[model samples]
Target: MSTAWQDLTGRARLRDAAIEAFAAQGFEESLRSIAARAQVTAGLVRHHFGSKDALRAECDATVLERYRQLKEESLQADPHQLFTHLPASAQGGVLLLYILRSAREGSAAGRKFTEQLIDEALILLNQSVSRGLIVPSRDEPARARLLILQSLGALVLHFALNPPQDPEDFAAVMQDYYSRVALPTLEIYSEGLFTDSAYLNEYLLATAADVPPATDAGITESR
Candidate 1:
């Protein structure tokens, strides 16, 4: 939040600050504390939101908007007859990190949130297959579970284990890791897993010419 943030209404400013501070520090942080972070007074915090609970609602809405944008961009129906394809580089920002932390704590609200996400995943996957947006699978429920495991699980691991503290540094790392590691791994899974595939063999054959020739001297050294 910088120059453009100056244009926001006081309420918007408070909501943005609440989302950031609460995500990093949890919802128990005081209104005064969030006000300080927002560079506003405690009076304004109450004036804008009336209560902490209302503030939390606004913060949640802010984050959910981010989630909505991601879903809209990622949910492709048909692309050149390739039913399954990777989205254009997935990302999760501060709001996602907060949600992960909350869910892992296993509070009633967190549990509910997790259940909703799982149900949504199941519904979306089942619909996609039923509508012929994706290839039919014998065990679609299992596939959906696997997808949630790989995608969301990787995110939880990254934020829970080790990620850069600085936002810019964190983004740079995500850019590289998602491009080089995460998405490719997903591609391999999307193409294989339940399907009959010779992908590995074909890949090896294509790249075999690049393999270095084994030398007798190296073999003798190994002995």
Candidate 2:
């Protein structure tokens, strides 16, 4: 498919092309092919971005930032509603492309992008906790990473096992999959793991005679 490469500035076109190529293939995909897709010389791509790694890093920011924006927008009331609330257009293709590609390469760009993805999910989880939907936990960061991995692993695996077909059908299938399966599976997560009666209550009961009960139901961090 031919794109109007000139419609974008040289740098923009290169970034766009890199995102396309990385999304279609992987980061290990040839820079020459990306330049050709952008209608520029391979050296021009290097001139614009220094190297293929840098180019893929730029693409990672481009696509994942948009993915984050879509996530933020869809998070209307409940953060747990993330996937189910996403529009069909924002459903799983490009983000998974970049993620899968980056994980395989294990390069600087890959690690940075992966960290960024985790950080973004952590932010959303914090939002949910702040909204009082999820209780805060001492292990918020680790739990956030687990949540991100759960969603991402499912998406990455879905793409691997069942490649994209008709766009409408794919969206419907994904939406159904999330509502019927993923949402329920992750439903307990939004409650925060510490909510279980296993420890917090017992701790409170044990300490009841020693100190006044802490008003905040969330776990406190040990200094």
Candidate 3:
């Protein structure tokens, strides 16, 4: 392959490594550690990404890509298939952990990434409403924002009390909570027209099945 191709491959590898490291260990881990995992030098990491902050931004992008893929796959499968397939811990654990760590440390990148994630989620929720999956009231955006905030708060509380559990265990708890709390809350708030357990389950399944299209020009452009 040409030098450019090799460079691109290396950069991609570095980015993936950064994602895994950040997801697993947060920003506390050094760039050198990330580079070692990717089998590249720290200098190369800097050369390609320019700075740690920039590399972190790339990591956020990678995580978002994975999120989109998981959501698509879930959606395409039988309703709520992802909840059955992915442990609740793994589904939202990394992002939750990252958020908690960032907030505790007062990291700007973490805050920014979290905001971006929320924005993306809101967009998807609106899209789901348009598709007749969720029925948000006139104040759909506000309601959606509250739901996201509550869910994140729950995650932080859970993680604070215990070490991260296995994904399956997390998934089981999430399934139960969604069935008991989230679904019911949505129904009550939306006057039984916005979302129900069945609909939410179906939506979660679809999102898990979703495999974010390769040509996400529109998604990128929206940002």
Name the top lDDT candidate.
2
lDDT of 1 by residue, 1-223 (tens): 4354554577788887787776666668899989998898999888767999888766765666666555545665345332233322223545455566556656766665555555556777676666656664444566666765566676667765665465433244445345556556757756756453366446545776753322421211111
Clash pairs, model 2 backbone: none
- Poorly placed runs, candidate 1 (over 4 Å): 1-8, 76-91, 122-133, 136-146, 167-181, 194-223
Alpha-carbon RMSD, candidate 1: 14.0
Assess every candidate by TM-score. Answer: 0.60, 0.66, 0.67
Instruction: Go through the candidates in order and give the C-alpha RMSD of each one to the true structure.
Output: 14.0, 6.4, 11.5
lDDT of every model, 2 decimals: 0.61, 0.67, 0.64
* Model 3 spans with C-alpha error above 4 angstroms: 88-96, 103-105, 165-223
Worst 10 residues of 1 by lDDT: 214-223
Residue pairs in steric clash, candidate 1?
Answer: none
Candidate 2 global lDDT: 0.67
